[model samples]
Target chain A: MSQLKRVQQWATFARVWHIYDAAWQNPFQSAELLKKYLMGMHKPIYHPMNDCGDHVIVINTADVALPGDEWKKRVYFHHTGYPGGASWTLAWELHKKNPTMVMKKAVYNSMDRSLQRRYTMERLHLYPDANVPLNLLENVSNQIKQLRPKPKRLDEYKEEEVREFPKLIDLPKSYIVE
Target chain B: MVFTSVVNYVRARGPDEIWRKRRIFKLAAHFIGRRRNCYSIALRNVHRALAYATKGRKLKRADMANLWETRVRAGCEQHNISYETFREGLARTDILLNRKTLADLACWEPYSFKALTDIAKRRALDDGLAGIKADTSIDRIITRGTLHRDK
Candidate 1:
């Protein structure tokens, strides 16, 4: 191959690093999105036997949002291989113990049960907050957009902006101040 | 040469026997143990391997087609468009590009693929196709269908 063609080949096979902000994003939905990058399904050269997967750096996993009451309702099961050693941990409880565990498990379960699952998981780096190592952060050239927009909290709005908001009815002068 | 007795005739083997066994042996040359050297075992393994090869040919095509679709879908996702919508938009606009070619463009010529997606997005929005977000701005795009309608 010519020098240009060889370089093109290398570019095509090169593994890319992507960064994702998991704050207020659904872990389950994010997992489905991240799984594509982790398994290299986003690449044209992807194959079951080929190692074309990319690295994904997820930050702010502790702030991930679960729809409805999943945080209280979802249960993670584990067994110690001994009789009566089974345990079930609620999603909220697990998150409190390890902030990144919920997001990590979500991505882990999203992928197919294959021999490469562990190796693929190794490429995923999750941080409880946006404090990633400088080395890893520098490697990220792309950003995976969140599945849904992060909802703005009422507290996040400035007092001036909130006070000027339109109202359908004027408050009565006799209305008691809480 | 005619055999003098019925027993001699029964014992005589055809000259093609060696060639027939050699063909099976040739296919089983890569096989291990008795399966490679023993004619009976080699023949059975060789037949199975040939059957797999015949089936594998069709499977390879299907696998490639699936891979192309995956690549194209991934490309579409990057631009915030669904694969079905992208294909539908392109079809409606008469782009006529196949999955293999679209996949090749997506991997090799990313800019070209992006342009294709932009065109598809415009076409999809113009037609108000389902599944489209309707958030994309199509002010600058001018498709053949749009030109005909404008005139």
Candidate 2:
């Protein structure tokens, strides 16, 4: 009877895949919503020690759009240890080369940096093309809630990020006067 | 009775305002002096606090600049340009841009930043007339040493 109840609970919580026709203007924001829609944060067994969640299948990564000129302006950097050896790639180029990477990066950034992060990431199914046939959103929607609004940027935070270099490039007073 | 006692005590004092000021100053002096029993120590502590606050402000400013430089360098690398190479290209092209401004521009207006890089590319291509490889634009130089492995 207990085993039967477990199966019944799984069936009740199970999601039917659904896709909204709305444009993915903010892929990160959409991903955050879909994370809940896919039941990525819950388990039927109610185990805190165990990672329990459902897989999320994301489609139309290539069609994901954004407002403003975020692609060309956002930069990602990497380095090689030589005196003059570092390389960079623009968000626009990355979008062209691998569209799914943009959303993946956003999702990765949004995830909590705990042991569960990797487990959660593994359940995220991202596809560049919009051809997935799973429509399990009904069961998923019940457990999901809209994300809390982020606080507005304050001037103090912006002022804190400003970097000012020393005008004097000469050696310190502790060094020899010569 | 308490009010009368207080009035009486105040009346016992002199009419001069200087004495009141002196009394306040003396109270402050005593309060501070009581903490360490030396006026020099109190003065030194105040000076030290000011010095620490000044140093802390300076450190915060420097740290912010370092963050900006790091972000710009990272942004430049994404554009296939090193912070140094990008600066060199900007200087060579006579573009008077600072790292902070460049970083903000890069984040807020990427297309314009790319145009700047393209200008550098055009200059590099034109200057490589002696078979120095015109295709080695700032981007190429920046990407030449990039690691392909995932971070």
Give the TM-score of each candidate. Answer: 0.76, 0.35
The segments of candidate 2 whose C-alpha lies over 4 angstroms from its true place after superposition are A2-4, A9-23, A37-39, A42-48, A79-86, A133-178, B1-151
lDDT of 1 by residue, A1-178 (tens): 9999899889888999999999999999999999999999987667778899999999999999999999999999999999999999999999999999999999999998999999999999999998999999999999988888889999999999889989898889789586
Off by over 4 Å in 1: A1-11, A82-86, A170-178, B1-27, B32-58, B78-81, B109-115, B130-142
What tens-digit string does per-residue lDDT give for candidate 2 at A1-178? 6999799667745644334321354777876666543332332222224344566666667766665887878776757888777878888898898978887777777765777767767767677785554454333333223234334455445553544533456668889565
DockQ, every prediction: 0.52, 0.01
What's model 2's TM-score? Answer: 0.35
Isolated chain A: TM-score per model? 0.93, 0.57
Residue A173 local lDDT, model 2: 83
lDDT of 2 at B81: 49
TM match of model 1 to true structure = 0.76
Candidate 2 residue B148 C-alpha distance from true site, Å: 70
| CA RMSD of all predictions | 4.9, 27.7
Write one digit per residue (lDDT tens) for candidate 1, span B1-151: 8656988878777668989899889899999999999999899899899999999999999998998899898788878889999999999988999999999998778889988888998888778788877664556888876676678
Q: What is the lDDT of residue A83 in candidate 2?
A: 70
